[model samples]
Target: MSTITVDLNSKVVPAAQKIWIVHPGRNRSHIDTFESAGVVFLEFPALALRPEIIADDSLLRQRIRYSTAVKANKGFVRDDGTPIHIADYPTAADTDVSVHLRTVKHLTTRMMAGDLVIVPGRGAGGAVLFGEVAGSFFPQKSIRAAGLPFADTPVREVNWLTKRSKLELPAHLVKFFEKPPAIAEVGRDRWSEGFFDFAYDAYSTDARSWVSLDAPQYDGSDILSLVPPAELLALAVSLYRAMEQRADLTGLDYDQIIARFYDHDALAEAQMRFQSPGRYNLKDKDAKLAKWINGFVALALAGALSACSNGDHIEFTNKQAPNDPANAELTAMINMAGQSAGGAVLTKAETQAQHAQSKLGMSAPATVR
Candidate 1:
C-alpha cells in the first residue's frame, strides 16, 4: 500500500478559518491536558499510526478498522486492569466505527494549523475555551516523550484565544457543547453559526454592542428606509430574546424569526450610524419612534408570525397568542407605541410576514428559521 509523510518543516497557506469542538474527554479525563497544556487531543489511539499512515487518511481509517478486530483493545482502558482490555467494536458490523475514524482523521489530516477549536467545560466555572491550532498534526506517541499533555494521543498545538462562561454565552452556544464527541464541527445552522461568529468576535461587530436594551430612536424616514417598522420589530424580538437570555438562539421560528429580522435591520442601521455617520445624521428625530414602530410591528407579527406559508400568500388568522412571552412583549410595545403616537398604532390582523415583506420592501433576510 502507498504511504504519505507529514512534513514538519512545510508551510502552506491555511484555508478560511473554521470553528471546531473538541470535548475535554469522557468524564473530563482529558481536562488536565486542556487546562494546563497549550494543545488539544483527540483520543482514538488504537491504530498507533506511524508517520506515513497518519499522513494518508485512507490508510489511517483502514488501520483503525483493522485495529478494531484485535480482541484485546488497549486504548480504551477499563476501571480494573483485568477489565482494561475489552472488545473495541460495539457491533459485529462495526457500523459505528465511522465516527472514530472521522475524529482521528480530522485531527491528523483534515484539520489545518489555523483552524479554531472549542474545548468546553474547562477553566474556571467550566468556561468554553476558544483556541487556534497553532502547530501541525502529530500522530499518537510522536510527541509523547516531548512531555506535552495527552501527547500519547493525536495532538495539535493550540493557542487558546479566550474563554467565556457557559452562562455568559448564548443559549444556542451552550446547547452546542452538549454534543458528546472527542471532536466535531459546529453545524451550518444560520443563526447559531452567525451567533458563534458574533460571540467569537468573528463578525467584527463586538458582541457587547448587541447586549444592550436601549435603542436610539431613529428619524421615522431614515430608520424606515433601512427596514420597515414591522420587520424591524420582528428582528428586535429575536435580539431582545438573545439579550434577555444571553444565549444564541437555536432556531429563528415564529416570534424567534421576528427577532432575526430585527437583528439584520439593526445591523444595517448600526453600520450607517458608525461606519457612515453622515447618513445617520438625525433630523427632528422622534425620540419615541421606537415605541410607536415596535407597537405597529408587534401588531403585524402577532397575527402572522406563526402562519404557515401557502404557495405565495400566507394566512394571518392565528392572532390570539395568549401567554406567549413574545406576545406579552408585543402587547407592551403596542401600548407604548400608542402612548407615544398619541393614539393606538393597532392594525387589523390581516396580513402575515410574507405580505409585509412584499409590501414593505423588507430585505429578504437570511434567517436560522
Candidate 2:
C-alpha cells in the first residue's frame, strides 16, 4: 500500500483554518493506504482565489453567444397512446421542464473570479469562458455573431467551477487556480476526500512538480509539510453567454494524454529531478536551484493573489533572496536537517504527530510520555 499527504501551511493559518488533506494511495489496503504509483501533490496559496463578481451580463452574452437556446428533446407524452410535446398536453413527465428552469436559476447565481464557463460552437469551435474576464472582453456591444454551427445546438454540461480536475487536467491546474468548494458548506466528513481528489487530478507531471500516489488515513493529529512547485502555467478561456458568462471544458482526458504520453520524455525528466538527492536537501549546489524554484513558485502565487496592474502580465520578480546572508544560512540549515533522518518520509499519524511536537518544542503529555 502507498500513501500521500497534502499539508497546507500559512503564516498564521491554524488547523481549523488550514486546508490540510490526505488521500489514499492507488493500491488500497482496506481502503486507507496512500500508495499509488501515479499521484500528484499540489499546494496553492489561498490568496490566488480572491472572490470578485461579474458586473456586466449583457456584454457576457454577446460575445459567448450563450443566451441562444438549443433545442432539447422534451420527451414524448401519450394521450391514448398519441405522442405530443409537453406544452401540447401536460402530464407527470411534464415535470421534466422544471429541470431547465432550475438550470437557468443556477446559472444566475453570483459569479466569482476564477470561475470557469464553457460555450459550444460549430464543428470544432467549442469555446471556454472565465467569469472574471467576461465583462472586460465582451463589454456591452452587439456581439459579432461568430458564424458557427453552435447556434441552435444544445449544450450539455454543468455551469460551475471546482478545484479538482475531472480526469484530464492534472491536479495542479485546479490548485494553481484555487477554486475548491467551500469547506463549511461541504462538511468536514467528505471535505478531505473531495479536496484530495481535486489536488490529485488537476496536476500533471508535465506541468506540476509533486505527485501523490496513496491515500493515508489522517486523524488530524500531525503536521505534514510538502514543498510544491512555485510556478505554474494554466490555460483557461473566457466566453460570452446569456447576457452573462459561462465556463467551457475541453476533454481533460485529451489534455492528459497529450502531456503524459506524447510528452512523456520531457515530463519524465521533470519527475526524475524529484528523486535527486539534493532535491530534498538544500545544502548542495542544488539547494540554490531549489531555492530559485521555490522563489518562482512564491512569485507566481503572489502575482495571482495580489492585485495586478495588468491582469494579463504575471511577473516573478523576487529571486534575489538567495543573495541575502541570513537566508543563505537558513537554507543551509534546512538542507542539513532535511537530509538527515528528520527528512525521511513518515506516513503513520503517530509518527507525524511526534515530529510536529518535536519541532514545536512541546513535550509529550503524561499519557504520550
Candidate 3:
C-alpha cells in the first residue's frame, strides 16, 4: 500500500504486461546462454515431465506430490495399486515448488511475445536487465543431461528492451534480486509505471515527487489496485487489528515491540500468508512466502493508515490508532503509519463486508469516519 513515485500523469498508459523474475542460476551459470541465445529458461525437475505431462497442471501437480514426497512402499506404486510412472510424479505440495512448476509450464504455454522479463543482477550484474519475451518456448530434447538442468534447457526467446543498465533499481523491486525464484510473476501490485515506462521508452522521472500515502490517487500503483476485493477487505481487517495493539502501548513499549512487529513481520511470525505473492490468496505454511507477504502487508497497512490521515502532513497524523491488532505484526503496520505521519493514529476501520467477513471468519472494524 506504500505509494510509489511512478509517472502517474503520463498521457498514455502502457499496456499491463506480465512481469517475471528469473534467476539464471545460483551462481549465474547460464548468463552466457541467456544473453547470447536471446532466451530465458527454466530448470526441469524430472526426466519424465516431458512436453505432454508438463503441459497439464493437474497431472503435473499430482506427479509432483508423488515425486517429491516419500513413498513408503518404495519403487513408485499408485494408491490404486497401479504402477506409477516415474516421470509423471505429481507436483510437490510445497508452494515454491508449485510456483516453480508453473514457471516451467508458463514459459512453455503462458509466456507470450512482449511480456517483460527481469534477469537478476547475478546474471546481469550490479544492474538488472529488462527484456521482452519475443518468441515461442523451446522444449527441444537436451541429451547433455536428463531433465534439462544444464545451461541449455527449455527456453523462451527474449529481446533486450533497455540498452543501458538500470543501476538504481526501484526500491520495491530490490527484494526480488535478494531472494528470487527460478521463475515467478512480479505481482501486479508491485508493477511500477516508472520502471515500466523506463523499460519501454526511457521515461524520465525529473518532474515527479515520491507519491505520499495521502495523495488523492495512486492509479498506476498496481499493488493496491489489482488486489482482489475480498483480499483487500481481509487486508483492511488486519490493519485495524494492528492499530488497536499499538494504541495501548506507551513510549518505548510501543516503539520497541508494537511498532517493530508490524514494521518487520519477516523477523517474527509473518501473519499474512498469501500465495504467488501479489496475486493469489493465503497460504500460511509457506515460510518464505509468509515472510514476504507479512512484510508487504505491514507496509501496505502502514501506508493505508498514513494515506487516510489528513493531507499536507505527509507524516503520521497526530491521532493514535484506537483499535488493537491481533499481534505485533499488525502493530508495526500501525506504528509505521503513526510514527512516520507525526504520530497520527488511524481510526478503527471495520467492515460491513459480510461476504468477506464470512469468508475470512473474523470480525471487521467499522469505517474510519
Candidate 4:
C-alpha cells in the first residue's frame, strides 16, 4: 500500500473539549422514557409538583399555598393537594422544597452553552443520546411549550444531536462508566478522552471524507482525504496501547503526549468526523498495526514541521527493538525531513540523557550497597 501523505494544512480539531455525562433519569421511569418523545429527560423529583398543576398558573399558585401551609403545619401534601402529616411519607427528606430548589439551581448553573451532554443507556439496554445545550435553564413550563411532558420542574433546553440513535460502547469504555455519576465531566483525562471522538464518529454522519486534498470535482485519480475518523481514533488507541506496553518510550504522561501530537485542531476534527458512517475494522491486525505506524509517523512529522517553523528541537524516543524494520524507516524519514527543513532533531539517546538529567535533581537517599 502506498504511504498516504496527509496535508499538514488540513484543519484538525481537538477532542479535549469539555463533555458532560449525564444519566437520562435517576431510575427506570426516567430512563428510555423519552424515546418516543425525542427528548432526553433529566428528572428532579424533589420538585414535588405535578406537571398539570405547574402548567396552570392558578392551580400552581394554590399548590404553592398548600405547600407553604403544609410546611408551616410541619406536614406533607399528597399529589392530590390533600394535606397529610410528614411522617406519612417514607422519603420526606427528599421532598424538601429547599433541597429541590438547590438541586435545580446547581444543575442549571453547572451546565452551560456549547457543552455536549451524553446520556448513556438506561438500565442495561437503551440508546445513548448526545445533545448540545442550545439554551440555558428554564422551568418545565418552557419545556412543556416544546411539547415535552415534564412540568413544574427545572430543565435545560437541549438540541438533541442524536435522536433515536443507539450507540454501543466498547467493553473497556462501558466499564469506565459502570459506576454512573449523576454528572461526570468527561474528556478531561487521558482514559476518558478518546470516548468523545469515538461516540461522535459512530453516530454523527455518513460522510467519510474529513479533509479533501484534491479540489472538489470528479477526477479519475483516487481522492486524497485525511484518514477516516474511526481509523484516526483507532490509530490513537494503538499508540496509547504501544505506550502502555513500552514504558521507556517517552517521559511525558498521557496527557502530555496528547498535547504534543493531538493538538486542538486535530482533536476537533476527529470529534466532528465521528458522525461519519465509516467504521474501523479491528479484525485485520497487520493492517491496523500499519495504520498505527503511519499515524505515529504523521504525528512525528507534525512535530518536526512545528519545530522547523519555530526553530526548536523536536524530540522523539523509540524504545522498540533496534532491529524493528519499521522503526528504522520511520526514524530515517523524520531525520531527513528535519535536516532538510533546517530543524534540530533529538535522537533517542539524547532524549534518554535529558530524562536522566531531569531525574538527577530528585532528592532520593543514596542506595545502600
Better of 3 and 4 by TM-score: 3
Ranking by TM-score: 1, 3, 4, 2
- Which should have the higher TM-score, number 1 or number 3? 1
The estimated TM-scores of all candidates read 0.43, 0.22, 0.40, 0.39
* Tens digits of per-residue lDDT for model 1, 1-369: 211111111111122556688887665456556756777765444456778876765666666664543323443443354333223323232445667767876676667776767887843357677777786765543334122233144467788766656555557676777756678877544344433432332111112112111123333455444444344444444434343444533433434335343444333223223221112211112212232233333334444322222111211111222222333443343333222222111222224433444433332111111
lDDT measured at residue 59 in model 2 versus the true structure, 0 to 100: 30
Top lDDT model? 1
For every candidate structure, what is the RMSD over all alpha carbons to the true structure, in angstroms?
A: 19.4, 23.1, 19.5, 17.2
What are the per-residue Cα lDDT tens digits for candidate 3 across 1-369? 343211111111124567777777556666556766677765443324566767677666775554443233333454668765655454445563666566667767777676778776553325466788886654563322222333234457799765324344555666666654577777554244344533532111222211101111223334444333334434433434444454433343222433443432322221232221112222222122222232333333334434433431221110212221222343344445445333232322222222222333322111121
Which 10 consecutive positions of candidate 1 have the poorest summed lDDT?
3-12
Taking the tens digit of each residue's C-alpha lDDT, what string does model 4 give over 132-167? 666655544323312223233345666665532334
lDDT of 3 at 358: 33
Give candidate 2's error at residue 290 in angstroms: 14
Q: By TM-score, is 2 or 3 better? A: 3
Candidate 3 wrongly placed segments (more than 4 Å): 1-14, 45-51, 62-96, 123-125, 141-152, 163-166, 188-191, 202-369
Q: Pick the candidate with the highest TM-score.
A: 1
Q: Which candidate, 1 or 2, has the higher TM-score?
A: 1
* Model 4: worst 10 consecutive residues (lDDT sum): 360-369
Report lDDT per candidate.
Answer: 0.43, 0.22, 0.43, 0.38
